[model samples]
Target: MSVFAGRFDGRVAVVTGGASGLGRETARRIAAEGGAAVLWDIDPDWLEEARKDVGAAHAIAFDVRDNAAVSSAAAETVARFGRIDILVNSAGITGATAPVQDFPVDSWLQVFAVNTHGLFYCCRAVIPQMIAQGYGRIVNVASVAGKEGNPNACAYSASKAAVIGFTKSLGKELATSGVIANAVTPATFESPILQQLPQSQVDYMRSKIPMGRLGDVRETAAMVCFMASEECSFTTAATFDTSGGRTTF
Candidate 1:
């Protein structure tokens, strides 16, 4: 609600992982601002809740890891909304914490499957539609861990790092296409994702932040909404920090 109502009037946005956490906040913001938000999540129960929470334009339960699902969902969204002006890739998983040498191979693969490959699939599916429409904004959620590797989070770090690189390349490719792509690197936040990490690791992350506090999803959502808005013109293939001064570069 920080953004003025009608700022995004007549717009349509797609938020992956919009069932909960940062994604949910972003979706809710878009809807509150007179825009339509399409929420995509893998959990049907949460999807139902999110639909109510955001008055979602559309809610679909499908794993982002499934290439076919992402493709079909993109097509369905375009059909439902007529055009999608914003895309927020907010779905991700922080794999079980462990040192690189001891990180279970299965866990590593699963992390990449969702974090790296899944994002790739979503972007691949949606970019064509955006290109066709001749106007779009894409915001990929990455992490500070991607920039400064956190101890015992090898897979999560690597996956997000890939997201950063992917966004940069995609942004360049669409530079002149009236479509822009960028990635946001956020510090630790109080969200469902934190439940997946070890308490000690969480404390460690918090201590590292100069602000000595975890970020709030509301705060992250503020930055995300701006990035997805027309006000973000001239910024693409860049990394934005919602890291509480943890990242200055």
Candidate 2:
């Protein structure tokens, strides 16, 4: 038997944006520890890839922005897995980087649609199920940019900052309950999302981190897994930093 043989044997986990980046890595780790994972993503192609990678997990091609879709996915996940024990809100978009004056209203809206509203939708869908079970672990993926706003990425920064606030508030709301909620703020990590940015912009982001290097998605995933694990019984409503010395305190 594996070391984590029964660490999460009967638990069900849902990872939004589980097709790639930190979400993919988190799902992979959870499965390795014997948890059943429900991978939710809009990318059908990558969703297949993630399913093959996770083995025995369910994949749902759903957009987090649609309330009904999110609700349906959550319901289906519970039907398949029996209970929702963990949730990682990882679906997010880095909106167009530009000055506030040049920022497009639609772009800003899109950022919030995924980064903030999407998270809320997932939480709304899953919280009752968690409450029913009297146990749940939630990890919201925010960014160091959220903690200390980043220039040229107003929408992305603001949306993530709102996520942090939301996590804190929900954590408190469930403080007396058995549910635990927290957010992880990572510095720039090596992920496919970086391909969307210009070289100069990427370099600027790298320069801001005192660690002088980008974080690995696995590192971020590890922190997230720890928070989601039963081992983390305390430490709710906190912002756990994996920012590599960026935005310290």
Candidate 3:
């Protein structure tokens, strides 16, 4: 009955940041469609909760920024699920908002660590497996901010922009292979990250979107699910936008 009905039957999916927000929603959709899922997150408490909610998916407490830990997690996932058909790099941090000159070095580094380095680590860990199997779908979660830089959020914007470029390069590299790599740029979504911002900042974000609203996590997850499905055969090296008309280009 679902448009994606049985599209992922018997496949295995690994979702970083699967404990919350878009990642959690995406994992649930994958599981509902009959794929075995591996949920990776740094928060063990929330990870367990999500595991129970998803019902039968594997949950692992591993920081995506830690390359060695990510590699080990990938191995464990393959051991448990046999093969990883879909990899969603959804773990990220919205670092401090400030002018570039006033931005703290620590905050900048942390943003890059989680948003950029962590994504690369996961890709490195998973690409070999995908290559060996000659099949895989990779969906990296970027942001509309990456396309048009947001004032006072230099680090977050830069990191996400880097993800877009990284996705493009990697997608081209794996174009000939059966594997597909793409990134999604979603605007302000109803997620925990909004809680960290001041009311004024949040209001400003919402006002910028022509749709006059924040995106729902489920909507973003739906797009991700489609990209990760076997039905997504010909669309690689693309950046899908779910920015509520905030991005006209």
Candidate 4:
């Protein structure tokens, strides 16, 4: 919470799933700090409302699972803002909470489509832009469930684990480049995504946290904002933990 009041002055960011959850809050923080944010979301109405509330530079309605759409949005974002200094892949979904045997194949695919495939599409579309500028930040929003698999949430957990792996590989590939890539594993937070979970699941998550509660959006966003800034130059392909002491490793 220290004031980096103009930390992002003249910067541009592309935030996926920016209409709500941690994405929205991160967009707000960036815009408030003087960066131009291009908010992308699957919900047209929600995206528009976020643009208005955050005063984002652009509001894009698109599905990240669609490679073409992600590519087009990246192009449009660069055209409008000139450069994409930061990329935050915060969009994800928790598929039906059920055991692997009981989990619908369709639901599993859908979860991976958004959480894994969507992330790949967004990063693929923008990494070249970051490399061209000789400087950029990519923050992939993963979950602690990835590291410690949650029972009955096979799809969600596996997808996030893939995210972590992808980020690690990307970090190594970009090691010598100016662009840095990292992933954050946040424990259960009071975000819109929580609504998708049953009360039992939610409570079970909270119970594991050493802090005995969920993390706040601002706390998670603060870590993300830092990772997205010039201050994060030395770290890449790293996993940041915002898990309220639940993850000591």
Candidate 5:
């Protein structure tokens, strides 16, 4: 049963990275609350399964790193759903764990390509639709490392910081346009993304959290859902922190 029944009764949400992790969790919550979630991910097989699990209105598999693909997906969504009321940019990657001096240039670029540029593409493609409709909510999933850089994880840290900066600029630009944009900074969390990192790196992150525990995806999803809701009326261009007390600012 939905705790906030009818909160998203008529809304349509487009969630990137919806195949797994926080994206999937958020989509599940939105659908439970009556929103028509449209799941987007780079994996078609996983995307199809998630579409059934989340009860999504649609599921499209495409690379967010490709602006043309992102644009096409946005148009397809508008064509089928009539309008997009929310966008949750949850697609990201954790590049190879290495010191700045040893970090592979290719790894750094790929991280930015997905974690930063992919997000930009999604926002660019969808914002026009939101503007035409006079209302929309955008929640970009950033990271606590973005605020305080993590050792040996230079690319992920820098890319997320860029996400925060980009969100601020976009929020200000759309402030008066009836489209609200915000970013969420989460601490080390129990997520599939963690699997991409080595145990030592994970342990290092866990050590930094004052709470001494990884955040549950549900906790972060709760924050995202609220920000995606019409109830988030007064906040825009702000960073909502879910860093388990790791980041107070």
Candidate 6:
């Protein structure tokens, strides 16, 4: 049982990339706390598995890169759950690990498509619902790479940096709307996204942490849950770090 039991008794949450990794864990936590979690992912099969594994209220399969699809998903969620109280943008991709000079153009664009543009689309679609309800919380899962750019990960780093900036602007815009927006920058951690990188790249990120260890997803989830709750009322347009002591700013 969650210590935050009943905190989200009547809330509804939409977590992108919810089939696995940070998104999946965050959804799990939200559901445990009594929130209705609506999971969105690109894979139908994985999404079903996650729905079962996380005990989500519902699941939708679609790429967040598609604005129409995101908008439709938002509508579908509200149709099923009545309101959207939380949205966690956690879908992302790390493009080819190569110096900027050698990076594949296609891979770079694809990274932005998923990591940056996709996040933007989801935010755009959900903001209207949140605004209509006069309440909502948005948590964009950025990365420490966004703060302290990692070598050979230009697309990923730059895109996440964009996420941080976007969240700041969003939070400020929604400050008085009773809708809150924030970004979380996590250091290297155990997640499916890690599998996309080379061991050397992973080691490089792990080495930058002063704590000498990667983060735990539950730790990130704890921070996310707080930010996605009414308890986070006072803060907006801020960046929360979970970099295991890697980022001081």
- Backbone clashes (count) for model 3: 0
Which scores greater on lDDT, model 5 or model 6? 5
Question: What are the clashing pairs of model 3?
Answer: none
- Residue 105 accuracy (lDDT) in model 4: 97
How far in Å is the alpha carbon of 131 misplaced in model 5?
A: 0.8
lDDT per residue for candidate 3 within 1-249, as digits (tens), equals 356767779999999999988899899888888888789999999999998897537999988888999999999999887898999999998888778999999999999999999999999999999999999999999999899988989999999999999999999999988999999999999998777677777788899899999999989999999899877889998999998999986
Residue 231 CA error for candidate 3 (Å)? 1.5
As for model 4, its CA RMSD to the true structure in angstroms is 1.0
For model 5, what is the alpha-carbon lDDT of residue 222?
98
* TM-score-best of 2 and 4: 4
All candidates: TM-score: 0.98, 0.97, 0.97, 0.98, 0.99, 0.99
**On residues 92-194, what C-alpha lDDT tens digit does candidate 1 reach at each position?**
9999898888999999999999988989998898888889989899999999999998999999999999999999999999999989899999999999999
- For model 5, the stretches where C-alpha displacement exceeds 4 angstroms are none
Report the C-alpha lDDT of model 5 over 107-171, residue by residue, as the tens digit: 99999999999999999999988999999999999999999999999999999999999999999
Residue clash pairs of candidate 5 = none
Error of 1 at 214 (Å): 0.6
In model 6, the worst 10-residue window by lDDT is 63-72
Candidate 6 structure quality by residue, lDDT tens digits, 75-193: 99999988899999999889899999999999999999999999999999889989998999999999999998999999999999999999999999999999999999999889998
lDDT of 2 by residue, 1-249 (tens): 335555777788999999998899888888888999889999899899889987638999989999999999999998877899999999999989889999999999999999999999999999998998899999999999899998999999999999999999999999878999999999999998888677787899899999899999989988998899899888899999998898876
> Better model by TM-score, 3 or 4?
4
Model 1 segments more than 4 A misplaced: none
What is the lDDT of every predicted structure here? 0.92, 0.91, 0.91, 0.94, 0.95, 0.94
Report residue 24 deviation for candidate 6 (angstroms): 0.4
Number of backbone collisions per candidate, in order? 0, 0, 0, 0, 0, 0
